[model samples]
Target: MSERVIGGHVAGLITVGAADALWAGLTVGSAVPSASAVFTGSPTLARGGYVLLGRRVVAAVKASGGAWSVPEMEVRRAAAELGAVGMDCRDLVRIGPFGSAPAPHPVHDEGTLLRWRERIARELQKPGGPERAPRDGGHRLSHLAGVDWRQILVERPRMGMAGSWWLPRTVVRLLDTAEHTETQWLHTARTRRIDNAVIEPPPHDGQAQAADAWRTTSQNLPTAPLRPYSGELQGLVYSVVSRKPGISRKVARWACAVCGTAPAAVLDHCHEHGYVRAPVCQSCNTQERPDHLYSNDIRVAGHYTRLFDTDAAVWLRHWHRCPGCRARATLPLPHLAAWTAHVACRTQRPTHREARSSRGRKPCGALRVSWTGGHHAPHTCVLTVVVDFCPSGEHRVLAHVPYREAAEQFRTWLAETVPAVAAVAGPDRIDDLPTHFRPVIADTSSEGQALF
Candidate 1:
């Protein structure tokens, strides 16, 4: 039979067993079978027979034969035993898997089985069935301190058969118990702080000095003091130090100059000059790495070193001009600042006076409130810098250095610093350049101003 048919047949048999037990209790003056007893006694072999009986019944059923069939005599004996306990077994014997008949009887029969089903249902509705007692909170604490295999098996029965199915019962039991010992060790290890603790090894004759130096370093570099760097970042620094020449791993563990908080994991250097740059954290290094012009590129590096004295002209000369368009691109600092302020204002509401003025009387004598609460214009004008190199005819922005002071700083870098550097180092030292110079200016005109 198909699994579905078999499952249905098994379900019918359980109902029969329950009904039989109820009948027996009423007729034989015997104690009524508990729900657990009914569930355990039901001969529906496919549905967790091993789980209900624990170990003994599982062994007996397995030893009898394959899961597909059980000994005919064993089935009859089990029926008789259940019958002796006052459970009606006639229906089970007539229509179950152990029954001699080939075909199953109609389940809707108006007879003893039907009455038994009703009686069992009514009995189940009444309270006072078997229940597991509340577990002591202290036992849980004790279990964590040390594992008890017996208690674990009783509480979590699936562990008993979780290993190899063909293995002997004793071996499976042993494996299940041993598995928790490893888990207990892992739990203990997680709770302990042992990463900073050093286990000293016995020193040999010649290595005494090296051992003393190692101990000194270890004593000085306590984990509590190194909270600035994440464990992963520290590991990365150690890896970089081992690979890179001249850079000490110990020094790299210190706080980064650029970020002041994170560890200096990467060795920053000028690609053009082949000179070592100051140590910086990974995040700052990543951000600045993309803008490096050459190995010995001192102009760009100098701008970083002297942040206040930075000139945009010096850095703009390093930018690549598009060969297709022959246009040099420069980012407008003032327009970008206006756009940033516009965006910031878009998130807030306007003053009460502005709100009332903007919402003047409509033609229908009704006031039309500003959709943005008079804080922002209905349409936003985006300010962008157009670079000559855009092959797709799209505007390319360099940086959003808005505000007058910041804009002046960027303009000075482009106009003064770049030319000054070129004057000393020779213009040919700079990368690709247009035949003519383009003046970088801040758009301060009313039309170019950002609309709020």
Candidate 2:
């Protein structure tokens, strides 16, 4: 009943199932609390039931992910890091283009981790689990799009639709087809451009499993026949990725930067670095990504601007509105404001190869904050910021206005840029500081600088 993914015949492999893929991939459009779960794809879960859940919880705690290294955590990471840059981890770390979160197994607390295991076990334990799809409205459900119910039995499960039948993408989308969110969940829209080579990779068929568990594996995968693209949209996508200094085909997706809902045919290159910011639809992409068409970028979108919350960090919900109200329309992405602003800031950053210049640059990007330990003298705590961020080895000192103003500015930008900054739960040892939080200021405590 171990959730270790390894068994008698599968010592070096993990037999992936549809549940693993779905739990690993079904991205919720809204971000308030993006639902996430880690799928072990162990064949034991079929009959493991509550026992599987209990075991996984203990194992998760033992992993001590950030602090201690456990085999469970190290295996996948080693498996991923060892197999050419992006192959082995594709199925396991299905985030961003070919990466996300560095390691995908650390996003759980004990309670959530237990529930994640329990959910999958019970879903599989259900009688005729594969056939019994989740309900939509009242009985007799007829048609369901985005799902090939027939193939759930025949085909192997892959990412995206590899979900529990109760909450497969088809079921979730079908149920929320009327969903229109005018709200915020700030996870950025990332690309998962899986090519033919990745579709039926090794994880899809690593080893055999119990017939019953294996049959239920792809229950969430509702797949249909493949359809080749030959439309204007395809041409638009090709044109966007084809242009030099435009979006590289690796991570460029057809999602817009303004309202993430549309097909982004226009590739918006950063005004400064000549790097792609976001691929916007005809309705989005503010920068002259294209000429003939009129585009509404996120900063100036009249109606779209009103959809954001007070912080302007995320979108607002359109669940409740008066008659004839279009509040339910999902215009820009859940993280449009932050993403646009982040991209806007990145525009100031010159690529590593480019020489630095200060024609018209915001001070925030160059600002580096250094703080003294306040534990000894809380009242005498001092925070200092320096203009030290430069690709070329050059540091500039600056006299900041007020301490509070500088701190807030740096904190906000740090959250968007570093992202992992807020998660710094004080390093146990000074040597273990998070990369960005590492002490960079010169050791000026004893007056003159000393040679190392």
Candidate 3:
């Protein structure tokens, strides 16, 4: 064949092959080359090359059966090609729809083009690029670059000192107000003082006259001095002190009447009768004297006597026996007193129905005993006590018994019931107990028993 005919045949085959490949890659399969590739290449050759390259990439992706989606694969292939060819795909922005002019062209210089291509490839490979395939291929490729296009297009005003030069009047006023408010806050915080007059110093000799004047103004008129106590008065004082079992005349004299701490340096007395009521520490004496003078009158003393008598009767009846097993138990004295007071109050203020109901039904003699593994098995056996009462019930904890005491009680009970087990090993031999009884026996020991 002639050279002219051969050249023409070759060109025709190239055109036909390009058209077929473009149709198959863009329409038949999922993969499609980016518009940037088209814009960067020579109009005839570049378009054919991209179309053919896209076809090959789609085929390879399908053959490999990669996990990557169609768009990801296309992007990877395009980036690799652009990087290898030293072509700036970003220069596509200077062409077509992205540029101001119609029908934009590629840059002429090779070095500049190569640098731009490198930058474009780097941007394309970044994490923030378009991850999913766009529905409208033409618009997405031409308009939305991998980078935020809005930031590039929109003009932002220069800020800080440079912005102050040409800022509008309203903006300047707002800024000034904000600055002033911030300045005032800082100044107030820096200068603020905290008053903490926690300790008082001894008065100087110069201030002795002033202090004396103040004390004189504040002091109440002195009452007649207490007369020598008769035998009857002494008996009355003893009776009142003995009512509260834990308190005695000696203890009352040493401890503060109000808080029950610190040495009792001041003797608090009834101003009207000139009778000493109780000894109190200096702080309590100063703070509570006026209130006590009114509240601790003859009538209040009579009420206290009645309360003590009722509490004494209740204590005699129930303080010696455990309600659960009818066992002789040593009740905590303070707890017994408190419980007696509660029962007395309840009985004094029973409703009409409650009074009638109480006559028929047996009275509630239930007592609560709680045991906890204090230091042993703290996480696992936090509360080992067999709680008999509802936790949410309106009942006060009478006393907190030590874990060791509760454990000893459990050991004694075990010794009595399972004498055979006690015979085989001693009462203290908690490890010799049956597997099922181990948890129960363990509860009675200061040191926890191992399960295994």
lDDT per prediction? 0.26, 0.25, 0.26
Give the per-residue lDDT digits (tens) of candidate 1, residues 112-223: 1111212222322235311221133221111111111122121111223321102122222222222222222223323332553432222433233333423432223222
TM-score to true structure, per model:
0.20, 0.20, 0.15
Residue runs of model 1 more than 4 Å from their true location after superposition = 1-221, 224-248, 291-411, 414-452
Count: clashes, candidate 3: 2
Total clashing pairs for each candidate: 17, 17, 2
| Better candidate by TM-score, 1 or 3 | 1
Q: Residue by residue across 18-137, what tens digits does model 3's lDDT show?
A: 332333333322221233323222221221111223212111011111111122233344334423322222211110011111222344211111111222223333355334323334
- In candidate 2, stretches whose alpha carbon ends up further than 4 angstroms from where it belongs are 1-44, 49-367, 373-379, 400-452
Error of 1 at 44 (Å): 42
RMSD in Å for candidate 2, one decimal? 24.5
Q: Looking at model 2, which ten-residue stretch has the lowest summed lDDT? A: 181-190
Residue 46 displacement in candidate 3 (angstroms): 82
